[model samples]
Target: MKVSIKREFDFIEYEVDMSDATLLEILHEIKTNQENSLAYSSGCRSSVCGSCAVRVNEKEVLACSYKVQDGDRVEPLKNVEIIRDLVVNMDKALETNARAKSWLAEFNKETVLNHEDEKINALQSDCILCGSCYSACPVYAVNEEFLGPFSLTGVWKYVSDKRELNAAQKIETIQTNGVWDCTLCNECTLVCPQGISSKADIEKLRMKSSMAGYSDPNFGQSFGGGFGFDGTPSF
Candidate 1:
């Protein structure tokens, strides 16, 4: 099988003797035998660590789990600085968590979650921080500061918690580059390896925002006479 990997400014193609192999395995073979300088990241080859994530043919996937095929074009994730071949600096993507304050603030009390309550944010808790959603998000193409999917999903996880006393504050924090900025295109949900729907979580956040008397900041610009449409009957 022949695979092409993006190295800095170029895509270097390599031939692999093995046919049935994971992308990570192919990368290992290439790095070990073909090119010693080939660089990629991997851990917990079982897809648990989420460190081996890369883009295959423009789709985000875990290299540890995805089986490579002939003529596969492997590239590093988007929307972040690429430290090297297939290795990106995740610090910027992770910074959104702190910027969005996706953690529990002002805990109400020591409350144990019942089975029902736990299910509220259960799917969201499974995020591996692989940054696949971050790559898939289109908002970053124009607005890099817009908090991406994983962070928003993390926000949902804490905001939904019954014990979190500052849900309103959390909602307020995401109003600018936070929740309202998301286009609801569902690209982030499609790329998440954990099956976590950041789109759904973001929608829930929007609902929560409405309940807290917050609306999209662009709501006025898009409506309410800001669009040059006066309250006149044009029919």
Candidate 2:
């Protein structure tokens, strides 16, 4: 099968024998025999580590699990600095967690979650930090500072926990470049490898924000200067 990998300035094409081989395997073959300088990242080839994520034909996928196909155009994850070949610098994307304060603020000593309570944020805990959602998110195209889907999901994870004491503060942290900034495009949800619905989590966060008397900052701007007090349209 023929595969094309994107480099810094160009796409390099290669031909390899791909008999039910995963993309990671294809990369290995190319690196071992064809180009000793080829660079990519991988660990826990079973798709557990999430370190081998790459984009295949504009779709985010784990290289360790995705089977290679003919004429596949492989590229590094988008919206981040590329280190080399398929390797990208994930520092900025990962930093969103800290910026959104997505960790437990304070523990409620008396709070013990039942099975039902645990289910509230169970799916969110499955995130492997693959950054697929980050790659697929459109917000970074315009506003790189916008707290992303995974970060918002992480916030939801802790906020939904009955043991967390500062849920309201967590909600407040996401009010700006956080929840309201999301375009609700659902691209993040579609690319998530763990099947976690970040879109739904974000929507729940929006509801929580509303309940806490917070509103979308863009709401007023979207309706600015159109109405008159005399019940007539202002031109």
Candidate 3:
């Protein structure tokens, strides 16, 4: 079968004997045996690490889990600086978590919990920082400073936990460049290896923000002149 890979400034094709092999295995064959210069990232071939995320046929997927087919197109993850062939820089994407303060500041010991208390945030906790959701997020493409789906998912996880102490402050922190900025495009949800619905998490945050007396100023407004203007004269 022939596999096409998009390297920097070039599309390289290679025909190999990797019948019914996983994408990662195909990449391995291409790199170790044929092309010594091919570059990609992978860890834990079992798909637990999420380091093997790449765009297979323009869709973000964990190469460790995706079985390769004939004439497959493979490329680096999108909307980031491509350091090398199939190896993109992930610093900016991971930084969103720290920027959004997506962590538990303090836990409430006094809060009583049931056996299934953590179930609300179970989905968010499954994320392995694979950059798959980061690669699939559409909001990050247009808004560089937008708190992305991953961070928003983290926000929802912490804020929903009954043991968390500062839900109100968390809600306030996400008022700008956070929940409201998310178009809920569902792109992030589609590519997650863990099946996390980041769009749904953002929706939960929006609802929480509304309950906390926060609102999107651009709500119901049309985009015009770099402002959310609804065809109204402001003179």
Greater lDDT among 1 and 2 belongs to: 2
Q: Give the TM-score of candidate 3.
A: 0.91
Distance (Å) between predicted and true CA of 188, model 3? 0.9
Candidate 3 residue runs with Cα over 4 Å from true position: 110-112, 220-235
Weakest 10 consecutive residues of candidate 3 by summed lDDT: 226-235
* Per-model TM values vs. the true structure: 0.93, 0.94, 0.91
- Per-residue lDDT tens digits for candidate 1, residues 146-231, read 99899999999999999998887898788878888899999988988899999999999989887776666566556765553432
Local accuracy of candidate 3 as per-residue lDDT tens digits, 8-71: 8878899998677899999999999999999999889998988888998889999988998888
lDDT of each: 0.89, 0.89, 0.84
Model 2 C-alpha lDDT per residue in residues 1-235, reported as the tens digit of each score: 9999998888999999768999999999999999989999999998788999999999999999999899999999999899999999999999999999989989888887899998988999999999999999999767889999999999999989989988989998898898888989999889888999999999999998878777776774666723322222123
Worst ten in a row by lDDT for model 2 = 225-234
- Among these predictions, the greatest lDDT belongs to 2
